[model samples]
Target: MSNDSPKLTPRQQEIFELIQQAIATTGAPPTRAEIANQLGFRSANAAEEHLQALARKGVIELVGGTSRGIRLKAGTLRGLHETRRAPASAGKSRLGSLSGLTAGNLPLPGLEQLVLPLVGRVAAGHPILAQEHIEQSYAVEPSLFTRTPDYLLRVKGMSMRDAGILDGDLLAVARTREARNGQIVVARLGDEVTVKRFQRNAQGVTLLPENPDFEPILVGPDTPDFELEGLAVGLIRKDF
Candidate 1:
């Protein structure tokens, strides 16, 4: 809104409006590919280029390696709503004056900070969860997940389709050396590693596949060689 702010080209302005509208309604911004689809651009890279330009122009801010991190420079509706609720009448008192009455006597912190490592391309037949394979780390607010994740693993297969985990989805994994029965986990069975909902009976433990097309793998008790790598906390999918 400032004259000093760099001006966007007509095409860039159109893309900016789309992003703004998306954030206003959904409380999150659109992905680069979504912008491309909206504007009928043939390549997602074109949308990414425009987004970078907007960031350079001070029109928006981008949080790398995470979905829905785009924030508009212009005030959002939530900001305007808070402004409207401020003390407007002479009789109406403000809460800031009573802050000392609270337990902490301080404003609440925004959100919990947790760094999640992004592990690319999990190989089903290998130990892909090794620490050395982490490509990047993303700082996320812990409130975003049901449980805090030790790291984020990029899902590579459609084995858990019925569990709603699709290929290319970001799986939030909580690191645990042991796992209880009937928890969805990232596990290593011998040389192979996989994500599946676990089930254990007197016979043995079964790695149940959520997708009907995929068969469940049974590991006998005699072969107690499998390692429970971690528990799945949550998932993230980029809309494009």
Candidate 2:
């Protein structure tokens, strides 16, 4: 270890190791929730406190306003690599070559980015864009989609399977009240949020599911709970 390296507690060391393991496996640091789950912490706040401690000790760097912003400092990074007792084969891990993964001190690209909140669940009576429903923010290139997205909502079911949308996919949505007749959209009915093909006529509005197993949702123009949240512009699917 370098002479300037700050001393770390045993728990801090364990957390640091877990962070590296997460980066090696997923190309990003684990979220506070993930770290809390792995370390048996009572809440994500506990993990956040430990991370603050690590940042103060100069072992790692944290970027403000970013959820997965943890980065191992260069001297600390090299020291950690040198202290590893694993076999040579283990050096082949992805962490060995993480160049270009980060821009500036951040662990992910910070340029040409559009940072939008990723919505998880919509509670009844709360607005769709309520702060409580935003799970995290994702930075993606605007050019990745045909239209720039206002937010990304996690797909909950396989109702749009025939449209090539599956559960666990991230549906990039453009905020708009008007959608073309055949456009895919994020529709809000009462407390339920759904992704489906939009069809509107003088009779009513219909949310058509692409899969045969699911039935269409018909909403009358007078329905107070029915609202058009956005148009589906892109999809992000992660491979395990």
Candidate 3:
């Protein structure tokens, strides 16, 4: 058995599944509170305890203060021998293939791996979709972002040129259904997607453009529904 597949109690297995789902869907590991909620525990501490147990068993790694920071150990795959053998070559296959089967295909060091698709445009505050907006996907480690971002946005306009987020730059975006004050975010207003520095007031939220020439956009307390797709985590520039 692989070291990644260390035996665990049923509770640990449940926690493992929850962490996997959170990482797959959110680009980050689930929080203690989220794990608790999913497992129907009354307190987040309960989930934390279980997670601690998992960490001790070498099945998962954890990064504190980061959402969805749990990384499943590689080499945990249970049935590698069955998948690797071709029927005709089953008898001739090398022992290395059977011995090398792990929980995941990549090495353990790559557990925090995440591949984010570069999107062409965002619907200003709406989620970036691979089918409709993605230009390409780049492999990245989740730790590169302050918060794990769900996708990358390909900037198209110069509204944020002054902020070093130039047109054509790829913006790493952390997906959150909600937004807080003073965060650089990808927002959707109507069908349009825009990147702006976000600020909020009692009156409403303002989407501020980095360039002084561009005016800040004010959203009324109530108006068209807006979406907070994600926060800007990092940027990458391609060479001409």
Candidate 4:
């Protein structure tokens, strides 16, 4: 590790670690109020102040207009992990070669990239990952996701815009057949696959959209052609 790594105060480190814990546990960042409650802060304002400091230090990026808009910057995500290990591991470069699996988890150490198959559309009655379904591949940093992704799906619509997932975003996905309530998931109903929050109750599973302009999709547990494809592990926005 270079001396260039951003330094955090003891309190800032505590708050930052809390943020990482929330993401790892719930697949989302804790709200300011959640942070305050977790750390016994008198108010969310105190949490926000520390968040602002972390943002200024480039340890995280605070997105406006969303309660869970806290995003960890890519390169620095694993830097925290770096501090915990023995000093010998410091020789590992977080920006090492781009190789992990298809991208070749390259023989290097630290935070490495995983070359994930970029899935396009799902043809009815076919496996979601059938070779023909993949449009290309993307080398994504695993540290950016709470879990390593099995693939990258290009989001095609704006139904999830309010959740900060806009059209054309690459939604990193970890293959899974089940999801917790409120967790975003990639699901296929009939011949269409959509990304939405997973909700279940007496009425069955409802794929709730982030945008009110769109209607939630209902999937009976026994609904034919219905399948849970994967969980939304992370997101990548194209710079166009």
Candidate 5:
């Protein structure tokens, strides 16, 4: 940050660092409740107040109407993408010359690009990333995904159209067995695999679709089989 930029309080600095760490590890910003829980705040309102303060300081941009809509500014985002390995020799700097590149661009062929498998339809009782399920592989910019993804799954329907996740788009998936409320995920039920928002309640688990016409998939105690394949980390729209 520039010296001219507005300064932050100690608490704000702590919250800011927490945000960076969350995005770096989980590929998505933490929700207000998460921030409050992590920092010992009594409620999410305190976290919201602090977030507003941070926004005024120009370190983060918050989009309303979404729980995980917080965005790190460009300067801070670069810090999250920095590789953990030690620097190269004098002649082989990782951040090479930028004569034809813009600042914060990290699409260097060998170092910054991510080769991800593109998964097609999955067979019953088989792994999602099975060899037969992989249609092809694509070399994508690591920055294109919030978190480094394990594979790209081609969306099959408009169930998530309201979320801007359309049919034929590539859904970047980070393989995980767990998910928090309101986060979108790719889940498998019996022999079927579908993408939907994940919600856990005392009653049971609910797989919610973004479109109103589709009914939520409710998983109760007697459900035959339920498994969480992965979390939806990013999206690549082909039609756009």
Candidate 6:
């Protein structure tokens, strides 16, 4: 290690290792919620502060305007990899304890699973996956969904029951600004977030709920409040 490298405290080291392990296993850095959950922190802000410290110490770089934009230094990553390769048994034990994951839980080289943030309610006009909105995160197998979702939004209503989506279900959503007609999407109208089938024409856009009890929402072409957050790619319901 170079003298220029910042000294990491035990907690800082653990957070740094978690970030690296996340990138190694999931192909994406962990969100604040993920780190908090893994570390048993009651609030995600603790993880946020640690990340800021890491940045200040030159251990990790934080990208502005993105939630999971953490970057590990190339030299630090190489050093971490070398540490993992040091002794066969030590490497196994270290890998086994990363955020409580063992080698068996990690995906093979070509098969990377995704760790998606579970977004709760969105504060009006704020980004959907903003730090405050993320409740937690879950890992899903790559082969289990239609497409890779950027995050999971908790379903709130029976608006799409006819389409098998229910209240309290977890909706897997892929990030995209555009949604084709007839596709289910997570959309925003002012402060409200809703799941509905999308349709558009020269006149305007119509958000159609599958349940007849709910009326379709009409947005004129020039409406400034309407925004498409993402497309619904898959669904998950917890038995508990």
Clashing pairs in 4: 99-103, 99-104, 99-105, 99-106, 100-103, 100-104, 100-105, 101-105
lDDT of 1: 0.60
Superposed model 5: Cα runs more than 4 Å off: 1-111
Q: Show the lowest summed lDDT stretch of 10 residues, model 4.
A: 94-103
The TM-score of candidate 3 is 0.50
lDDT of each: 0.60, 0.70, 0.61, 0.73, 0.70, 0.69
Stretches > 4 Å off in candidate 6:
1-112
Q: Which candidate is the best by TM-score?
A: 4
Q: Please give the TM-score that candidate 1 achieves against the real structure.
A: 0.50
Which prediction has more favorable TM-score, 2 or 3?
2
Model 5 Cα lDDT, one tens digit per residue, 1-240: 333446789899788778765654544567899999999999999999999999887767776655765766544433334432224322111111001112134334555678789999888889999999999876666653455689989889988765556678777788999998877889988878899888899999999987787999999988876889998766554422
RMSD to true structure for each model, in Å = 14.1, 15.5, 12.9, 5.5, 8.1, 17.3
Best candidate, lDDT:
4
Question: Over 4 Å off in model 3, which ranges?
Answer: 1-112, 122-127
Candidate 4 lands at a TM-score of 0.78
Number of backbone collisions per candidate:
0, 0, 22, 8, 0, 0
TM-score of each: 0.50, 0.54, 0.50, 0.78, 0.58, 0.54
Candidate 2, residues 1-240, lDDT tens digits: the string is 434678889888788878766654433467788899999999999999999999999877765544555656545654544444356535432231111112133223544677878898898788788999999887765533435678889989988765556688777788899887867789888788999888889988999987788999988867877889988765555444
Ranked by TM-score from best down, the candidates are 4, 5, 2, 6, 3, 1
For candidate 2, the TM-score is 0.54
Instruction: Look at candidate 2 and tell me the lDDT of residue 220.
Output: 86
Total backbone collisions, model 6: 0
